[model samples]
Structures are given as C-alpha cells and as structure tokens.
Target: MSESKSAGEIRLIRLDRIEVLNPRDRGSRVFDEIVRNIKAIGLKKPICVTPRFDANGAEKYLLICGEGRLKAYQALGEEEIPALVVEVTDEDAFIMSLAENIARRQHHPLELLSGIRQLVDKGYTFKSIAEKTGLAQSYVKEICNLLRSGEERLIVAVERGAIPINVAVTIAGAGDNDKAVQAALQGAYESGALRGRQLVLARRVIDKRQRLGRAAGRPSTTKHSQVSTTTVIRTYQDEVKRQTALVRKAAFSQQKLLLVVGALRQLLSDENFVNLLRAESLTTMPKYLAERVWPNGSHV
Candidate 1:
C-alpha cells in the first residue's frame, strides 16, 4: 500500500486550479470589499485547501477555506497564489472550514449559527463543534437555542440579512413569527419607516412585552390609517393642553415650596441664622445661605 499523506506533507497549489466545494453568494458588499483590499494590498493570506482523490486514485486539490478570496483572486485574474493542501477526513475538513470561517475579522452571527448547525446536523455535537471550530460550547448552545424558539422563517430572514440576528432571536423567542413578519412586511411594504434601527426597536419592544406577559403589538397606540385633519388638530391640541397642565402643576408646586421656605427663613431670627452659619464649616456664602435658609427635615 502507498504511504498515506498527512496534513503536514500536503503541497502548495495554484489559485485557479482548485475547485470550490461550497460557495457563498448572498452579499455583494463583502465581495466588493475583498476585491478592493486585494487590489490595494495583494494576496497576503493563502487559501486553505484539501486534496481530492479520484476513483482511479489520482490526486486533485479542492478549496476548503478562503472561498471568497479564491473567487476574488479569480475575478482579479491572478495567475497563482499560495495555498495549503491538507490531507483530511470529511470530519476534519468540516472542522477546518468552521475554524477558518470563525477566525474571520467580521462574522455574521446568523452565518456562524448556520455553519455550526450544519456541522451538528452532520452528527457532530455542540461539544465537538466547539472543539473543532475553536468556539466555546456555551456559545454553541446559545445559538442553537434560537432554532428551538420555533421561528424558522425569521431565522432564515436573519441569515439572509433581511432582519438583524439580535432582533430575529427575540422574535423567535416570542413564538409569533406570523405577527412579527406581518408587522415588518407591512411597515416596509406600506409605511416609509422601514429602517434597520426601527426594526431593532420593534423587536426590542416585542421581546420586552412578551417577557412581561403583555400584548406585543404595534409599539405606538395610534394606527397609520389616515384620519381627518380636524381630528389630528384636535388630538394635537389635547396633547399640548395635557402637557401644559402637567408643567403648570409642577411649577406651582415648586413655587409653593419656595414661598414656604422664604416665610420660614423670615420667621427665623437674624441672630439664629448667623449663629447656625457660624456652627457649620461652609466655605462659600451661597452654601452657608442655602444651609441657613432651609428648615431641617420639615415638610414645606
């Protein structure tokens, strides 16, 4: 029998020669950024690859890591780049892919979740996934808990970047993807307030209400359906009057207490005020005056 090749003995290969097993095509922005960087700095990192053995026992190489980088290099029409052709089992190949993905400078939480979930689906436990991927088991558990939250469509949306992962997790836990999706779709489809920040706020509000056992619906009580200008004006006036009343009430209460303080101070003899001031070690006249002016613990 031929000597089995280990990972260390694997050889470097040309960039264009290796075939990509899996391709990520969702985000153009990521590809664009990679293209820009490669154009500026050139290839600084080698794509991790695995040797493909044919039915006839011929050796071929396939890309395992740097899938995006390989595509970018091909697009740039580079002749050859550095690569590591490691001999690996299928399990080790999967683990290596996971490791390379996690070490990326920017990681999409949902993408990471999906990759780990795939490994788990392939008969790997959270423990094994963590060990191979260099992620903690606790992190794996936290992410896996999301799938059991019973919102498959929301999870898909999160992975696709249509919705944020943080918000998706909350919506998943709320057990009402229909309501959340309907609200989001309508807001984005109908209303002009379909910002990412607004989606995050909506998810936060829904999660908060769900946790508190309260109804999770539109955050604002008023509906977006149109009403008469007269009704709108009336509502606006009512709100203004209500706020004005509160402000006046607060101002009057403060004034009453100030008047009481002034009367109490006047009632105190000047000699008593002077003696109280001398008793305390106040550094400034205003501080001494403030201390002498107020009665101790007496409700105004």
Candidate 2:
C-alpha cells in the first residue's frame, strides 16, 4: 500500500478488494477464449492495480488494467489472484486503463468508438483523444460523427471490412433515396474509390440492405428473397470478371515461368555454369523446374 512500492513486485490480493475502473466491451467469442485459456494454463499476466486508503483507513486497490482476466478468475470462483500494485493517482489509473484498451490490436472497433465517446463526454477534445489513442484526428472525428448519427449498421460493416469507410460515408449521406445511393455508388466507382469486385460487392450489400427495408431505418420482420433476374445477371457478370482476372494472372505467371525455365535450361548446359553451381553446393534443382526441365528424369 506504500506509494514507493514497485509494480514489478507481484502480490496475491483478494478479488473483492480490487475494483475494475474501465471495462472493455468484449464479444462472447473473446470472453469464452479468455475463460478457456485461463482454465487451461492459469493466468498468464497479473492484473495491475493501485492502492488507496478507504474511509475506515483500510487499503482498497483500484484496478488499472486486466478487466477480462479478473472476470475470468471471478467466473472460475477464485478468491485471491495475482496483482501488480503500482503507485499512481486516480487520473493516472484511468488513463492507463484507456491506453491499454486502445493499444490492444484485438480490441473491437465498436469498443474503441465507445471509449472515444466516453473520453469526449469526460471533457476530452478530439485532438486529445487522437494524441492519447494514437489515432488520426480525422479518423476519430469521422467515427464520432458516425456515433452521433446512430449509424450502427454502417459502423459494423466498416469495422468488419465488408465496406470501405468512404463507401459507407457516401451511402450514409444518400439517406433514404435509392436512386441517389445508386448515383453515389457510380460516382465512387468513377472516382476510383471502389474497383472491380469491391464495387460489385458494395452494390450487392446496399441492394440487399435496401430490399430488406433496413437501409431506411425501417424494422421489418419479413425476410426478402434475393433471387431476381437482375441479381442473377449481376452475379454472372461478377463471376465472369473474376474468372477473367484470374485467367490473366495465370497467363502472366505461365509466361514468367517459361522465361525462367528457358534461362535455367540454357545455363544448365554450360559446363562452367554447372561447375559454379557445384562449387556453390547448389546441385539440387527446384522441384517445379526439375519436373519441367527433366520430364524423362535424365540429369542435365
């Protein structure tokens, strides 16, 4: 409980004494994995906490990080857990919690958005949030705007990489007008913001959302069928384009392979080149080139 105590010293503390300052909004998949790992191998990392004196002069620790691990331990019914107590103020504890969550690579985008909103509500400026979270100001601003607009579906799609942010912005700006949305998609394609398969997929997602009446904020319990003639034609066209692209790539690769094979064949015939290869311990040919150059299994 001393302020001079170092965080490197790990101590066993009562679970009920430590408090979680900021909890992350983790999905069920993440929670289950954490529980499973903890149950299997035990806690890999100790939770960080700061000591504080309560009204009765009793020492109570405030957690700075490791909310998930704490939850897992609690779920496992563990009373005492390993904790690293650091000497920091209340503000520092909160900032550390925020930093840890934001710095995590696997943190959900929605959780990050929520944390940014919390910071904004706590009187932090956009610039401050950007600096603290190491995110660009424009990106933070855009996400904040999306949060303000209540664009939950778009947020999910963008986070999941189902659509680009620019495309989502264009679609969101188009409001309830399907014609305007289509025009915007066309403009996006022309501007090179979307290309080939991405453009096609974007169109399909928008069309599906529109047909389900979900794009305009309407709640419909009916599931719409997507087996129309137009959809069939679009699918066929996309498949053709994809196949054509694949064919072109394969042709290019084949040409390169032929060039390499020809060069290797010419080189292998040279006694000096073969001597150099022997000197360098490079006698074994690559499997692909070997199969192609020596189809009859005769050594060059």
| Most lDDT-accurate candidate | 2
Off by over 4 Å in 1: 1-12, 55-58, 152-174, 177-300
Model 2 poorest ten-residue lDDT run: 212-221
- Residue 170 lDDT (model 1): 48
* lDDT, candidates in the order shown: 0.61, 0.77
Question: Model 2 residue 215 lDDT?
Answer: 24
Candidate 2 C-alpha lDDT tens digits along 1-300 = 112435556899999898788865565677889999999999999999999988999999999889989988998999999998888877767876886787677777666766777777777778888887888887777767766766656655666666778778878788768789999888888898878887777876775555433322223223664578997996687677667757977999999999988898888889999899989988897787898877788664
Over the stretch 32-144, how does candidate 1's per-residue lDDT look in tens digits?
A: 88989999998777778777776788666667788878888888987676786777766566656766675555665445655776776777777876776677786566556
- Clashing residue pairs, backbone N/CA/C < 3 A, model 2: none
TM-score of each: 0.50, 0.59
Clashes of each: 0, 0
> TM-score of the candidate numbered 2?
0.59
User: Candidate 1 overall Cα lDDT vs. reference?
Assistant: 0.61
The RMSD of every model to the true structure, in order and in angstroms, is 15.8, 17.2
